[model samples]
Structures are given as structure tokens and as C-alpha cells.
Target: MTPIVVPVPGVFPYEQLGFTNCVRHGDVLYLSGVASLDAQGQVIGDDIDAQTVQTYENIGRILAAGGSSLDRILQMTSFVVDLGRNGGGYVATRARILKQPTYTSAVIGVSALMMTGLLVEVQCCAAVSN
Candidate 1:
């Protein structure tokens, strides 16, 4: 089957950034790294706790737009820029967002992210009912 590009809206015009928010093929959906930015593409959260919340909120919207949801996630990978400095807060925030029966996920530490103030970027794969 031909892959359907899910029109998952991002905080900014994603096409200009050389990416689509999410794409769906068959029953699977793949998402780009979701960030903690607001509609104007401004970084909303400085700390890990605040950033994680905003990042996941962005991911939730993308998943929904892709005809899926967080619970259907098969795997998730988070890129953390300040893991060494803010690792605890990142883990705690992630734990709060991902409750019981959480999906499989991995966190990778990076020296820096694309954005200066960004602490985390979350991407995932999920099964879409549609």
C-alpha cells in the first residue's frame, strides 16, 4: 500500500524544515522528533520537567493526527541534550507522562540538540487503527 503522509501539524511550518510530522503506511505510523515549542515555534520550556511535558504534548497531537495514540506506541526514543545535568528531572517527568502499561522507550543522551534551549526531542512508532 502507498504510504499516507499524515498531516500532523507542528509548532512551525514543518515542510520548510525538510520534514513531515508523521507518516502512515499500512497500520504503522512514524513520527519525527517532537519538541517543546509553542505554535509560534518558540521554545516553551527551559528545564527538563517543563520541556518533557511540552514535548509529549506535541507528540500526542502528532499521534492523534496520525490516527494513533500514545497507548498504541510500539517504541519511543527520546534524545536528551542535558541528560548529564538534568537526568533525574527528565526521567521523573517522563514517568509522570507515561503511566501504567507504558510503551517501550529508550532515552539517548546527546551533547546538543538543533535548538539552543531545547532539552529533549521525542520520536515514536505506533500502530494506527485507521
Candidate 2:
């Protein structure tokens, strides 16, 4: 099947990355891993709480462009630089933003991410109804 790419105006067409924000194949929408970059592509905040919020917001925008919404998200995967230090805040943030608690998800702790100041990254998979 031909993939349909969704470009959130300021987020996609990453010149150096060569990838879009999200791509749709059949009924599934595969979203790229999103960081805490704002509309201008700069890291938004200093801590995980702030970064998580911005990351989720970025995911929301990409999902909308993919013809879906946060409610349609079937699965989510979160990556954090330090889980022992920041896991609670990340879970709280997810609970606050996602109105319903029906999606499947996983959180992982890693040594580092692509950007120095970034503390969190979120990636999601959504199912589009036909």
C-alpha cells in the first residue's frame, strides 16, 4: 500500500532527517518519535515535566495532521533519560493530558537522547477507523 505522510507545517520536512512527522498505511498511522521541540524547532523547557508536556503537544499536532486524535491513539512508547528521577512526572503528565486511560503504553529509561537538553521523547501508534 502507498503510504500517506502527514506534515505538521513547521514540524515535518526535516531537512536533515529526511522524514515526515507521521505516515499512514492502510488503517494504521505510524508517528515518528517526537521530542519537546516547539513550533520553531527549539527545545521548549529545562525539566522532564515541561518537556513531557511539549512532547505530548507535538504528538497531538502530528496526530491531527494524520487524520487522528489523541483518543485514537492505540499505543504509546515513552523514552526518558532517567526513569528513577523523572518517571512519576511523566506518568502524571500522561494521565492529565489523555482524558481516557484506555491506551496501551510503555516507558523506557535510557542513558541519553539526541539533544542535550531534551529529557523526554514520545512515540505513538494510532488506528484510524474506516
Candidate 3:
């Protein structure tokens, strides 16, 4: 099993957090939960709409680095801090980012996230052909 790690310039060192961006075992790519953080590792956006966009963009970069794409995504799990206000917003944003047939997904509402003002987090699984 070969593990793949996608490192964005100036992104936080995941080792301190005890995780990698993505891990590849055979053809399957497992991505860690991604937050809407900028290159400086600071959370971005003021609302769910903006945060969701950044989250998807981070996922896109990871997929591309792992030799995959959004179309190859097999599963997605999203966590939202405010289910009532931002849940639908995340889905609507995803629909625009991922225009292809939707993959299996789970949206969970939680009391809070690791950071303040952080509304959403997303993780995904993708399979790439050799």
C-alpha cells in the first residue's frame, strides 16, 4: 500500500495533527477531512457559501495530486456546525462544484467544529485507474 500526501504550499504540517492529506492503498484514495483554510492555514470565508467553495477547492487539489478528479470520487462525508442554516448551502455549493452524477454522501450536523467560525468540513474517497 502506497500512501499519497498532497501538500499545499504553506499548509499546516499534518504530522502534528497526526494525519495526512490523502492516503492511497492500491487504487483507492482516502482523503482526510478538509476544512476551508487558506494557504496560510487560516480558515477562510465568512459564511457557509464561501466556506463550502474553499472546502471543495481543497478537495479538488488533493484529488488532482493523487491522479484523480471529482468525477472519480466514490464517497463524500460532510460535517456542518449549523445544520439548519448551512446544511442546504453546502449541498447547493457542492452541486455547482461537482456537476457530474452525484456520488454516495453523508451530511452530518455537529455542535461545533475545531475552529470558531468554521462551518463545514469535508472528506472524500476516490478510485483511480492505473
Candidate 4:
């Protein structure tokens, strides 16, 4: 099956970056790692809690654009710069944001990401209606 790239308006500068925010194939939608980036593509948060919320907000937008919702998410993989310091806040923020609490998830510790000052980055796989 041919995969279709998903676009979320004013979210990420995917065109300049040479990548799509999300892609759909068959019944699944795969999202790229979402960071705490504003419409101008600058990192937005100084701490983990704020970054976690922003990351998920970005994820929500991508999912919506891809014909999926947060509740339809099947799995999430979050990469964090300081898991030990921020993992709890990340988990708490996620719980607060997700109404269904049904998706499988993981939080991984990383030394750094593509951008500096990025506390967390979230990627998801979700079910999209055919």
C-alpha cells in the first residue's frame, strides 16, 4: 500500500526540513517525534513538564490531521533528555491529557536530541479509519 504523508498546518516546518509530520498506510498512522516547537519551529519549553504538554499537543494536532485521534493511539515512544528528573512529570502530564488511557507507551532516556533545549520528544502510532 502506498503511504500518504499527513500535513498539519502551521505546526512544523516539514517542507523545509524535508520530512512529513505523519504518514498513513492501510489502517495505521505513524507520527514523527513531536517536540515542544512553536509555529515558528523554535523550541518552547524550559522544563520537562511544560515540554511534555507541548509535545502531546503537537502530537494531537498531527493525529487529527492524519484522520486519527489521541484515543486511537496504539503506542507511544517518548525520548527524554532527563528521564530520572522528568519521567514522573511526563507520566503525570500524559495521564492528565489522555482521556482513554488505553495506549501502550514507553519513555526512554537520551543524552540529546536533534534540537537543543528539547526536554522530551514523543512519537505515536495510531489507528486511522479506512
- lDDT (CA) per prediction: 0.83, 0.83, 0.83, 0.87
Best by lDDT: 4
| Steric clash count of candidate 4 | 0
Per-residue CA lDDT of candidate 1, range 24-117, in tens?
Answer: 9889999888889887788997889999999888888888887888778888888998678877788898888777555787889998888789
lDDT of 2 at 100: 98
Per-candidate TM-score against the hidden true structure: 0.91, 0.91, 0.89, 0.93
Point to the candidate with the largest TM-score. 4
Please list the residue runs of candidate 1 whose C-alpha ends up more than 4 Å from where it truly belongs after superposition. none
RMSD values, in order shown: 1.5, 1.6, 1.8, 1.3
- Quote the positional error of residue 82 for candidate 3 in Å: 0.9
Model 2 TM-score, all chains together = 0.91
Poorest 10 consecutive residues by lDDT, candidate 2:
7-16
Candidate 2 off by > 4 Å: 12-15
